[model samples]
Target: MWGRTARRRCPRGLRRGREALLVLLALLALAGLGSVLRARHGAGARAADPGPPRTPRLGRREPVLPRPPVPANALGARGEAVRLQLQGEELRLQEESVRLHQINIYLSDRISLHRRLPERWNPLCKEKKYDYDNLPRTSVIIAFYNEAWSTLLRTVYSVLETSPDILLEEVILVDDYSDREHLKERLANELSGLPKVRLIRANKREGLVRARLLGASAARGDVLTFLDCHCECHEGWLEPLLQRIHEEESAVVCPVIDVIDWNTFEYLGNSGEPQIGGFDWRLVFTWHTVPERERIRMRSPVDVIRSPTMAGGLFAVSKKYFEYLGSYDTGMEVWGGENLEFSFRIWQCGGVLETHPCSHVGHVFPKQAPYSRNKALANSVRAAEVWMDEFKELYYHRNPHARLEPFGDVTERKQLRAKLQCKDFKWFLETVYPELHVPEDRPGFFGMLQNQGLKDYCFDYNPPDENQIVGHQVILYVCHGMGHNQFFEYTSQKEIRYNTHQPEGCIAVEAGMDILIMHLCEETAPENQKFILQEDGSLFHEQSKKCVQAARKESSDSFVPLLRDCTNSDHQKWFFKERML
Candidate 1:
């Protein structure tokens, strides 16, 4: 040991060398650690901030979350500990957010319903002005069953804030026997303070059709506007819709519906021209890009465009005209086919259906429906029986299981149809919906490819892109009724086709193939081209004798169909519900 005076000190050079060596070792260790970190994180270089999420679209993937905040002085050991603590807090907040999202069903419902939406104006709307003073006062009737508090209240406020006081007569809220605590006396208490708002509760749970009828009967306004409980009215959403109805009482007009993101709650406006409502042969609702013919036919893009169907969520109609046309098929249960029934009835019963592009309203479309849909199936059968006529075979081809489903009495509806002397479905199809595909030749062998084991998963052929280009990998996807990709037509000749392009190609399979592919339907049938429709709903191959099945690999988020032995397994039992009729 050296004294403070350093009488017996070591060599200065040796001391300096030891100090330098220690510093060098520390530098080397830091460099090595930095290189390891770079190698690991270089592939996924993250941005400091990723801004807000994009608006959700129909059949599109969920948007990415915004970047979380980070501390600025996160350096050194103590700072590192503080950073970890902050990260943990963020994690807790994320968990709480997820819990709230799960309960609300839509992410936006977790936020304040009174929260402001971004202003998006349609160019056509800006250029035009409606006779707002002359437009009839509208009785906005909204119906709900167990709707979230924010979602329901937001719809009410959106209407109140957007609509002119003089133009809006009242907002009728029909609660279909909601069991939620928030919707009980608390809801009544809230509504009691709001002017021109009435809350009606059904003693028993009635379907939307009847619930709407109840609201309509109670309505005193000249025009009746029906909106879903989860909707946001834009600045001028009401004026144009009411103007169109005022122009023609027989016109059942709908506004341009903008989508409110189900996951992120971002409001997406009409970016392109606009989309009009259409239906497939199955009578399932669909959206199509405006045809050039329609553009030429209309006086202007802002002008009301004739539509063959309504989405059932939002529409404005003259109260007298609504009553004259038979308000709704009162027999329709819980909710499913009333929109199509109303659409068909409107067309066949001498009423015109149109969509007003100048008016825009945002609607929340959930990924999964909130309520039970078995009643919707029953309601669909009722519509087919009453209105579809001989064309109903096409519907049955798409939904074979619906034909035998117990749908309550439609005798009154049938009498109404006959009493009105409604045009035959043929004339309506030829005249009103000529663009719709007619599957008269389609036999009843094809439908949704539902797996017996995985009841939720279906054998879907819809390609990744909405466009069904040739050689697109056909995979299993969630079925939304005989939709574009969901359509399956199993021919009498034992060939399965999709989306009504029969004879173009049948669902082809080959021996020793792990996955199924859509090959061209040849005039001269190959061994792989042939298939056998078993009574058990399995598609058995003529060559391989294996049944068609969707893979049961751990996750159902995505998967493909596979070849397996025909057994009593539910996996093998599949329903080709949609046909190439």
Candidate 2:
């Protein structure tokens, strides 16, 4: 229900090559976090306030990257000697460990937010100049939960430096109750100089979902652009997205996300091809290659590609349409299923979602999310209940115990759906996302293994204990409720395979051996590898004639399972329940 508008730049003394905006951009950007820290540290000794916070001149001068401050507990002399002794492998591991701790980013946040990246415009886009003078004004919202200071400020810098101020209304920063000492009032004070930047602090911990909703409520722009706290907006990123929306107001547009290497802080732009979003039956979103049909129809790389789903971190939506379409499921607790729900809602509610290949933004995809996933599961359930219709069974089939998980009240969401008169999930599947593999929802037992007797512990294949060799002992650790390491799938092939992305490996043992080992599953498992799940929920190995039981020596605390004679003991009694991702 929207149309494209071809506009040109405003006549107001706007300089070429983004030069005229440097002075204004400098004032509107935060002082380096390193500068702020040094000022605070020298406050007792220095006479006056650190002479007018360090200003960032976006286009006028190159910005210097900041280094991480050495920890107070650092071991000095002995550490240096240990490093020398390490020579090779030990040193590598130590460096890798330190890097991993900072969410697998560079040894430090050393990249300038305003640093120029390779221009990613297709020839079609670069050759055509549009009138952006009347494009919809946008408000970029970023919500963070205990994020690193430098990275957060850099994200803000990237936007101001790359975007034309006329189209950008403001940038809203929402702190989701971060406990970091430096992220306190100081962060607000530092950001105060940036006229276009507004900082909001939460009184209590609200996860990313609620925090973003709060940000959206405070936004005043015609379009709301959501950027992750660690992203860098490349040159010309904003124009294409807004231009697409200008063409069609109801169209939700997202940038082609480039990779910012987790370890090297390198910028990896598009590989000259486009990608789309998809999800598995588990409701987990993943990036996949564009389908062959889509490639054949929209042959040009520059053509706008309609996406079935979003990867959840970044996108721009029309403020009016976002509200009319139902902003977000407030009942959804945290950040897991919101993107998928929004994608389905957009397609089902008569709006279209597209990814503009011309827009490029670099996002830091952390190896693991920082928050607890318990709420994510609850959130996914809410989406399934409100919008999935009968198709929700596929989700439940993958996460069987989700039926027992409690999601908050969905009556309001369901009513909202009815009020909007949205299309069903089936229509979305048949039309928008036919490539998604639908699960059969066949009933069976799968997930985490729990020892009925030792309720305090669960079966864990954690490293050193289980990652060592074929016969490495698996231990029982206190239940963490996260099945990431403990999850297993009981296949029709009669093999117990770990429920990771690639679950080709299964639990098995040799004919005469009592020790269980992780091995690649065969189409037809041998008698020793086969296991029968009795109606009583106990596994009986046909070859060994014994029940898999967790047995501990009297003198040791080690609770490792083994092939013990069937005594029907509590240790031998086990049950399977789905684990939250």
Candidate 3:
């Protein structure tokens, strides 16, 4: 037994060698695991911070979140213009397109619902990053009335395709009681399969303001994103907006609105200096070049551009903050002055209104507005009465008809202003929009320019249409006493400005013709636009060396203003509304 035990115990060296082999295997496993962990850490770091900025590839596909596949060869893909050879039935389709949505709806139908848009973002925006995980989720609210099937659905699909699923809480489509066939059950069925999409219908026509309010009421997200029914969102548009709102809850941000040609459906991105919102004394929204102050404040091209007012169709705001600011004026009938009202409220009520250059949205700007109802005048009146304070006189001075408009009771809005302890409109003009040209500043000879000869006749400068504002013929019509079309201001600069709106036109001699026309006012007060209202009431044109005379046109019974040799005739003599008073 002792000999057998000694033989078994003699294998101690071999057992030690086996134990050493096990230790070596254990060390190798640990090394492999450490390499894997290090690789994962590197991948995560790459995702979070894409190393020091390289030259941004303008349209580079940076799919941090899974995105919809781009149909590279599809029609209207890459935001290219789609034109159809007008022949046979195609012409009728084009006509139908015009009649329907005032856009090329026929071509819109042919485009893929998930069509890819060209990356029209600035290089700085492309290089910008946002914390996606922590950003607030938004409920996209799109309000529509008689919207086309393709355009509305394309808007929906574009958002879904571009927005990260986790960040998009839901999409609420508020149909403003559209009577169209497709908008009823077809819209619902089409949206049924789409996750996080809801369609709510108004029992009666609620108009845009109320329709959006309905959508906001039903939203269950941290932020409310309002988009027009005919918009194509670019990739990464949502993140920057959410990030801005996340950083400052009171910030209401808008995307850089690119133009989608209504006729050709081509996407036009403005990579140049961005335009900010401004308004004239008439309370109409106008786009102005970014002021030097605002430009200086923007450290990068991707920074937010402060605006006096928003274009209004597309913007994002924190849900809680929006509600606190009263969302929108419920009394506003339709879509006219809502943007300005919201803009004024935002600035006066301790909120930030900004345009994020990092986010881009392409909107179809129709050549002419399809809707006939222009409650804008009434809506503007309400806003002026409620918020404009003493500055409301500036709006009223240019728009005397607004005084008669039965703008619904603004008591509630006034109460809201008082409740919010909002700053007066004076602060808004002086602090926020000092670049705006205030006619009252250089109040010289303003109001209806009445002809001393033709009793009750005044210089009426009505554009044949909204598009014909520049270089339109000025005519003499019966003075309406209303300040709109007849509103003329003989500026201290010796220019007779047709002061209806911004970029105010000056009474100038038509090239090679003695006819009086409205030309864009030049800064130099050139000889053509220069007019001297003599003490005798004669409007002497400096360049033409003639006086403006009311001449009866040979073709029609109507009279037109013409430049002729200076005379003592009563027709050449004019009196301003201020003088008449």
Residue by residue across 498-557, what tens digits does model 3's lDDT show? 767887788888668988888888777887888899999999988878888988988898
What is the descending lDDT order? 3, 2, 1
Residues 1-581, model 2: lDDT tens digits: 21111112221122243465776577644555545665668754444344677654232111212223444334221111112244478657646744544444333243343455556557677764656556788899999988877668878877877777667888999999999887897898888877589998889988888899899999999999999998877777888898888777678898999877555556677647678887766677767778788888785878779899998879998898788777888777757888888888887777778898889898867756656667878888888888899988656755666788988788988887777677889888888888764433234556577888877667777445322324444567776655556756676767676534322356787767776777655657777778887777677887788888877746898777788888767878887766545
Q: In model 3, which runs have C-alpha deviations exceeding 4 angstroms?
A: 1-71, 441-444, 462-473, 478-482, 508-536, 540-546, 552-558, 563-566, 578-581
Q: What is the C-alpha lDDT profile of model 1 across 1-581, one tens digit per residue?
A: 11121111232344577689999999977877755566567745443333588654222111111112333432211111111233576656644544543322433433554544555655768766666556688899999988878778978977876777768788999999988899999999999988789999899999888999999999989999999988887767888888777766677899888887665566787645667777765556778777677788898767888888889879999897788677888777888778999998888877778888877788878755766777887887888898889888776765656666898888888888877667788878888777665543454555666676776676666555433434655577666664445667666566666644422445676556756778766546678867787887676888887877767545556677777787777777776555323
Instruction: Return the top candidate by TM-score.
Output: 3
Q: What lDDT does model 3 reach?
A: 0.82
**Ten contiguous residues with the weakest lDDT in model 1:** 58-67
Q: Pick the candidate with the highest lDDT.
A: 3
lDDT comparing candidate 1 with the true structure = 0.71
Runs off by more than 4 Å, candidate 2: 1-101, 104-106, 442-581
